[model samples]
Target: MNTLFMHCRPGFEGEVCSEISDHAARLNVAGYAKAKPQSACAEFICHEPEGPQRLMRELRFAELIFPRQWARGEFVPLPESDRIGVLLEHLSNLPTCSSVWLEVLDTNDGKELSTFCRKFEVPLRKALIKAGKLQEDGNGPRLLLTFKSGREVFVGLADADNSAMWPMGIPRLKFPREAPSRSTLKLEEAWHHFIPRDQWDARLNGDMTGVDLGAAPGGWTYQLVRRGMLVTAIDNGPMAESLMDTGLVQHLMADGFTFKPKQTVDWMVCDIVEKPARNAALLETWLGEGLCREAVVNLKLPMKQRYAEVRRLLDRIADGFKARGVKVSIGCKQLYHDREEVTCHLRRLDMKPRPSH
Candidate 1:
């Protein structure tokens, strides 16, 4: 076996390598990961022959903390001249695939490779169709070809249902001028990432009520209001006059850490600037005490050991919920709009069987 490659936020390659190494070991699949800081990618090679298939079966992409995109494949090196012929020759040997996506590392040089990919896709598609390898309507494996340069590439296959829809795991969203701050995009992105699109209208019902802790200027509250939710915006500072004018928001001049809703609400959102552990504790209190049905919170990270801190905070939250005999659905992500922080969504599952994993 060649290797399983994963792309992540540049400079966090070490964290991805560490996590994948642990997961591989946990599954009793021996492997070693090679990662370099700022490389934007990592590769894991297994000592066992069936490790790649085992990894695909055992690990879900959403559970990973650092890796944004991944594939199980071997590297393919193309010849300098007559590159199309070399690409076609390699394609002829692989299993039939229905779709294809060309990727590159998230780096300065890697960005420039997109132009070449755009030009190459046309002829590649034609060749694939002519060779009877591109099934138009069939549900088959997706071919992910990651270009390191013009001549160097990695050819991988991952199930379409299990992979990300975006090319580099980045979603394209337009900022609404009505929102007071760009931070509104963070919540929008978080919703898109955690909540499946088919269930959005149901999850964001019009009659929902929510409280926005640290909701100065109403950036996050704007999203809640858009869903027709009555929101209590908590903060000591002044909020955007435009948001208050809508009559859907009530601004409270109170500290977020000490404030509590008068009754249980549908949602609780927090964007306070504090240590990761403190923010985690606040979420724990809200969900554990049954103050809200669901909550979205952001935790700022330190420069060193960012992954470790996230794990510790999540563990604390999980422990608290377990002690209270509650089952909580917890999700976390480092959104494109975030800087040195990760957003988390926690929802209480009172009537459902708690997941052991």
Candidate 2:
């Protein structure tokens, strides 16, 4: 049976392929890929006689949808009506996903406002007519409903309650209507995809320490702090007062590239507004000097050739690490909230390397 993984962003197909190839090769495995023209997705065929689910599960940004050619309904619960466009783009990228529906639950009084949804023939998978009638605690059924025009949307129901939103092409995302702060969920979404959930758990358990380059306002730092890890936030600007209050953060008002950590950290994260190459070099310096064990950083891309740039950088980073007898596992994704940039996650080959500055 053929299983496929759906990667976001049409432009980054080549980069996705390169990253996949490197990942497989690093594990001493092989696979084949070609553009899946019909859906604008990449089809990686595992020539070895096993199913591709294992590989798909290992991928960070690529989502695994089963029964390659099957059609199913998808419900995307938006934070508000404004997110409709984001919902649309996300649905469009699914290899086997289509026929979108919008379920606008009335939040004034919590209720399933499926009037618009009914017009599109959205199946009443479950009618919590009363559920949609209550005043929304900002978590009502503001879902972006999708499926093959005439198919049911419950084919691959996830165990989570947030309602899954497909990873679509996003240039940038504004803040959602009901978040505690005015920060953009779209941007956070993009940033979240860089590091896999598994790796995130490790960091949160105090199994890691990281450096947050250009970490002002502490958005990324907030994520690290919640994970219960110490973060050396390197930035000249002030971080959010709440972040400093956490006591796990060490405010380092200095240049990220020039400042070396007192000891080897578990990870390095950068979000500086420098050229991609400069960011790449900074990562190299950290790795070359063994300042950190692993990394997850952002590369702000130029308007055009964003895909090409990602490919080039990944190759350089991999080559650099390999030459130094360091093995690395890396993945990049154009997340649901990303704009003109991509995020990378890297793990060192030598899990237990000697500490060096």
lDDT of 1 at 81: 80
lDDT per residue for candidate 1 within 1-357, as digits (tens), equals: 357888877888877787788788888888899987798899889877567767977888776777777888788888888776776787777778988888888898789998999998888888878887788677878888889999899888777777665776777889999999999998988888888899777677667889999999889999999998889999999899989998999999999999998888888998999988899999999999989988899999888888878888888899899999999999887766777788999988894322221
lDDT (tens digit, per residue) of candidate 2 on 106-154: 1321123334456443233222122232122433323323232222221
Off by over 4 Å in 2: 1-200, 353-357
Where does candidate 1 stray beyond 4 Å?
351-357
TM-score of each: 0.93, 0.56
Instruction: Give each prediction's root-mean-square deviation over alpha carbons.
Output: 3.5, 11.0
Say which candidate scores most in lDDT: 1
* lDDT comparing candidate 2 with the true structure: 0.53
Model 2: how far is 343 from its true place, Å?
A: 0.2
